[model samples]
Target: MLSEPTFSFTNFQQDAVKALLSSTGISLLAILPILILIVRQCGSAHPAPPRGCRRLGLPPGHSNLHDEFDPKYSKGTSKDVDDKGQPLWRVKALFTHPIKSCAAVELNVADVVSTGFAFDRQFCFAEQFTPDQASTSEEKTQPYWDARTLRNGHYSRLALIRPEIWVPDPAAPDYAPDLDEVRSKGVMVMYYPRPAGRGLSSYLVKLGIALRLLPRELSFSVPLVPPPDRASAYPPVPVKIWKDTPVAYDYGQHLPQSLREFLAPPDAGASRPLTLFRVDPTHHRQVFRNAPRKEELGFQPVTGFADAYPLHILNIASVHDVAARCARDIPRLSVRRFRANIIVQGPEAYAEDHWKRILIRPTGAKSDADAGVEVHVACRTMRCRLPNVDPATGIRHASEPDRTLKSYRRIDPGDPTNACLGMQCVPSVQEFVIRVGDTVSLLETGEHCYIKLLKPGEIVEGV
Candidate 1:
């Protein structure tokens, strides 16, 4: 027989005070002077409230938006302009998939208040930890495992791969769901190397040497451990791994001969080339020279990937422009190394590279006038080396025999070899649908604004 436990307010209060004193007394004492000095310094610096604090009509040091407004705010002025200073038609598209090379869900109605998206990268697959090995007795007895615990610099290789797994089915109405059901399914993972080496198979081999957990060949058989069970625990939902690799876009210019030939047909007899773009290797070299090293760069150690702060935006138009320069009907341009989030379709080739601000909205969602959630494009997307690959075909674009016939063709007898036909530098708009569109007006409270361009060679601030 069990007796019911009783609580008294007096005893509870006494116990609470005792616990607080025991746990925080030393910390509070040590931190009090530091806090006081910080407050005093801040008070003397402005004497008046900071902009965010003033907006709330609070005291100098008080603010409701403190948690919301980051110090990086107030770096620039918002603009409202059109392509030709006339109202231009614009639509917003949101790429719900933040991770590169993953399927994306487009939305007509999205909310972007202050942070990025309402539901951005909400789920991810967890790579198994070494302790998760079945051979380990300690692992067998542990009832649960945390996916985050498995993430560390030692496990950096996991960042290169995205496990092909499916999202777990939500708990049913009648019964709690078993989270492990999703993990039982095998996952498909791909790897991208630091210097852009071979895919997952090779990278795993290198990682195996670093971790000494097992041979690279054994990585496929390992099972990921689950997080410890707690009331507040919200395990990541595993996504299904499609056995086939998704179509990849390489932004870097270097391409392997085999891939290029596969994409480009020797003559018109071949099927339409699959759409792809190659990055300019020379350009990548320049970018890499200026880029900061890993130690100077900020990254999420757990994910082993660079943080989203310094996002790299690639211009679809730029790729289109480069493709147009090549012989007509060149099957595919390679874009292997450059990893990007949202690939846009518009007029200015590489126009996004020169943008100071951009806005993304859900398709058919009411404009900012109606919804408060819209993504604020903070910085320009930078360059990376993932674009270089051997052209699928053995022939180079410039070396093809078709170049002689197509390069000399004249729209009119008077047209020059390098004539600007309004089509030469036109931005490439791929056929994919976007839930959002880019914008120049960061302060506009409504939709239907025009796109504006930033100065060329202007490095995005803080990136």
Candidate 2:
């Protein structure tokens, strides 16, 4: 009788299915509220981050500096009637030096910033010779001397050290995840020619480099823009450039050992400790002389690590004139030897000498109304023995260009004893783009007498 009661297979299956369904319903009801909450959250837009946070994590190639303004405008046609039937003056070449006294970065397109080109003379190599009296107690032990340039005889090799700027591109497939980190922080990969092996090997290696057969070089990178996140890492210290003692970010601690060793080999006699320094873009070191008055400029014309003005514009025709004046045996002179930020063609020999104001129209700009950049041609650029050092070989020439230039190019009334070639300029617009084919119109011309404005009680040696 008990076995017969347990033999209802169909009814037992129905009861099992009903029990499973009841449990499943209860579980779904319990999770329904959580599921709805998640869906609502996913549909709603995310709140934007704070401005400061956004700046720290800005999109690649974007900067948040208040002074660095990016204005929107159309690049007009290059043809303009201002040429007045003369040969149209056009930008033949554009050059920027990420590191002062180093090889130039020739560009077809360059962004003009408040401090001249986007990255011109932003970084420089300096050697510590003596502790400064102005050093704070904490920094006194590791004090650094004033900034040194390629003008120093031993630093002639600096010309051989080439620097290349790398701005991250997020669109690239191999793009780094840390785009903002690389952008604001800046990246400058520098290469230096190095001798490999001995005699034949060394010669072969160098020949290969010259002939595009092999690369015998050493390279290292440094931050072109000082990282805001690591502001504390690179402490602000007073560094003298000429007579002005502006605070600069000292990258001495982070200096790569390989770079320091190469620039200042221990074997070299009495070599000072070499390190890199970057200008604080925020620091307003006004260009006192050969610059437009503050009222005329709207803002004070300032410079970073430049000898005097924000820009140095050279005329290729003038360079050719200089070459013609040089000894017949002398090789063809390169415009690069002058280290100009802008080089123009179609201008007569030394025609820039009388230029007081110039307008740089975009390649497609037809007139000033079509969006153009104005620059105050400040004064004539004074020359030193620096140009004597060949940019290609880093070898100093024995009285060639410099000697010839001094003979006839000493035309600056302010410093007539010194040779002058290029015209120092300051851009009127804070931000704009200048291209290789852009038109250069001499807006106004006047006799410019170079003058150095001195702060009260400050004495400049050998001026």
By lDDT, the best candidate is 2
Model 1: residues >4 Å from true position, as ranges? 1-165, 171-176, 181-226, 229-304, 307-312, 326-331, 334-337, 367-378, 390-463
Error of 2 at 144 (Å): 3.6
Model 2 per-residue lDDT tens digits across residues 1-463: 4554556789989987777579666665655665555445543323222111112122334322221111110112233434554325778678788788998777777888878887888877776655554433434555556677777766888998877676655554555555543545446767786544454444544554575444456665566566666678887777767677777888787565656555665445566667677898777587766677768768887778877788889877677777677736456566778899887776777778999898888766566576787888888888888888888788778787889999888887888889989989888877788877777887899898877657546655643
Q: Each candidate's lDDT (Cα)? A: 0.30, 0.70
Prediction RMSDs, each to the true structure: 27.2, 19.7
Q: What is the lDDT of residue 243 in candidate 1?
A: 14
Q: After superposition, how far is residue 263 of candidate 1 from its true place, in Å?
A: 24
Tens-place lDDT per residue, model 1, 350-408, is: 34433433444333345555332223333333221112221222222333222422354
In each prediction, how many residue pairs overlap at the backbone (N, C-alpha, C within less than 3 A)? 62, 5
